[model samples]
Target: MALLEIENLAVEFQTSTGPFRAVDGVSLKVDAGEVLAIVGESGSGKSVSMLAAMGLLPWTAKVTADKMVFDGRNLLGMSASERRKIIGKDMSMIFQEPIASLNPCFTVGFQIEEVLRIHLGLDKAARRKRAIELFEAVGIPNPAERLGHYPHQMSGGQCQRVMIAIAIACNPKLLIADEPTTALDVTIQKQILDLLMRLQTEHRMGLIMITHNMGVVAETADRVIVQYKGRKMEEADVLSLFESPKSDYTRALLAALPENATGDRLPTIGEIFKGAAQ
Candidate 1:
């Protein structure tokens, strides 16, 4: 069975103008030890879809799905408490913004320990030990010392590592990384990706990587899903998607990659379509 599955998932937000549908009829599944990449431009609902599945949307957002299952449990049918029991323990997410996601007032150690305490029922001493081990596991230097530091004290890369440490603390079966390397330098981005892949391999966890960067998809994904305008445009194995994309939108995305440039200026999606039309 797939580690996670969602069918006909949709999310609509109640805006001042009207109800705006952000995700429409999106469906996806990821198996254990597989890396699935969801790629799209900004405002394509890539992050919204996953957030809906995680039940993280706000009250103004109306989320509905025909079916949403995780590890054989029906996520759509679970109560708040039941879902809470599963969300952090069985499934975890590394959010887009590391520094913003963390609490400014508390030490990083306290925040991660809170997760362990709530889900695993670990005592104080055990939580601290596990936190140190987790920090070490994610390649943070001076793990014990870093635990007491606030999010602001660490560099962006280190803060991101702390987020990874927290996400994997409970040994989740699935991990959703929503643009985890956003705003980081290229070097830091590569390091974070490598660390994530290493952890995913070690734990055999299903990984869903939400990203707009084609390079990230090539480096990490086993399969790819292309989304545009709140709908799925194409789905294929990573190799096939790159070599022979079926959808024009996917082709346009590939064409926009820097390595694919063939002229003085890279072609925009409109230019690509216009040239094809001519």
Candidate 2:
């Protein structure tokens, strides 16, 4: 069985207009020690789909799935308390915005230690030690000193690393990174990506990377799922998807990438067709 299996997952929001389908009948799987990327433009339901899978969607949202399984357990049938128990230990998510996710008043060590204390049931001293080890493992320099500093004191890359440390503190089987590199510079982005890859190799963790940046997907993902307007347009291995895109939407996204897009222009994904275009 797959490590993570999402079958016919659907999500809706009851808005002023009516019930809007943000995610419509999406299904995917992630095996152990593999990186799967969900790539699309903004509002494509890439993030919402995974958020539903993780049971992180807002209370106002309505989510339904035929089967959402992890490690042979059905997520859809589980209680909120049961799901919460599995979240940090068996599955963890590193969100897009580090600053927004972190507490402004607490030090980085305190934040990570909280995870250790709650998940691992460690004492204060043990939690601090584990937090330091986590920081070091994520490549934070002078982890002991850095531990005492708040999130605002660190650079974007460092804050991201801290988030990573916290996420993996309990050695989760699955890690969901939602646009993790969005706030970092090019150099820092590379470092963060490399760190994630290295940690995945060491821990043999399944990864779900959600991003609008195809370049990042190309570098990190083993398989790619292309979404447009809450629908999946294409799914293939990384090489095959890049070499020969089948869908018009996929081809148009590749075409929209600029020649010198590294530091300058971000690629713009093409609009989804209402139907087959002439």
Candidate 3:
């Protein structure tokens, strides 16, 4: 069975003007030890869809799905408490903004320990030990010392690593990384991607990578899902998707990549779509 599955997922926010749908009829599946990349431009509902699956969307957001299952459990039918029991223990997410997502008042170690305490019922000593191990596993230097540091004290890359450490602390069966390397330098980006891939391989976890960077998709994804304006545009294995994108939107996205540039200026998706319409 697939580690995660979704069918006909949709999310809408109650805006001042009216209901605004952010995700519409999107469906996807991820198998254990597989890397599935969801790629799209900003506002394409890439993050919203995953957030809905995780039940992280706010009260104003109305999420609906025909089927949402994780590890054979029906997520849509689970109570909030039941979902909580599984969310951090069996499934985890490395959010888009690591520094902002972390609590400013507490030490980073304390935050990580909280998850362990709540999910795994680990005692203080065990939590600390596991936290250190996780930090080490993610390649953080001076893991024990860094535990007491606040999020602000660390660099962006280090903060991201801490987030990764927390996400994998429970040895989750699935991991959702939403723009895991966003705003980092290219070197750090590569390092983070490598670390995530290694950990995913080691744990044999199903990984869903939400990113707009085509390079990231190429480097990490076994399969790709393309989204545009709240709808799925295409889905294919990574190799086939790159070599022969069936959707014009997918072709436009690939053409926008720097390495694929063929002119003085890269053509925008709008321009490409407009040309196709003509």
- Candidate number of the best TM-score: 3
User: Lowest lDDT 10-mer window, candidate 2?
Assistant: 269-278
Alpha-carbon RMSD, candidate 3: 0.8
Q: Can you write out model 1's per-residue Cα lDDT over 176-212, one digit (the tens) per residue?
A: 9999999999999999999999999999999999999
Clashing pairs in 1: none
Per-residue lDDT tens digits for candidate 2, residues 179-269, read 9999689999998999999989999999999998989999999999999888888999999999998998887677667753555555554
> What lDDT tens digits, residue by residue, belong to model 3 across residues 1-278?
99999999999998789999999999999999999999999999999999899998997799999999999999999999999999878999999899999999999999999999998899999999999999999999999999999999999999999999999989999999999999999999999999999999999999999999998999999999999999999999999999999999998888888888899998898888777767
lDDT of 3: 0.95
Ranking by lDDT: 3, 1, 2
Q: What is the lDDT of candidate 2?
A: 0.90
Tell me the spans in candidate 2 whose CA falls farther than 4 Å from its real position.
Answer: 260-268, 271-276
lDDT of 2 at 25: 86
Off by over 4 Å in 3: none
The lDDT per prediction is 0.94, 0.90, 0.95
- TM-score per model over all chains: 0.97, 0.94, 0.98
Going through the candidates in order, what is the number of backbone clashes in each?
A: 0, 0, 0
Question: How much does each candidate deviate from the true structure in C-alpha RMSD?
Answer: 1.2, 2.7, 0.8
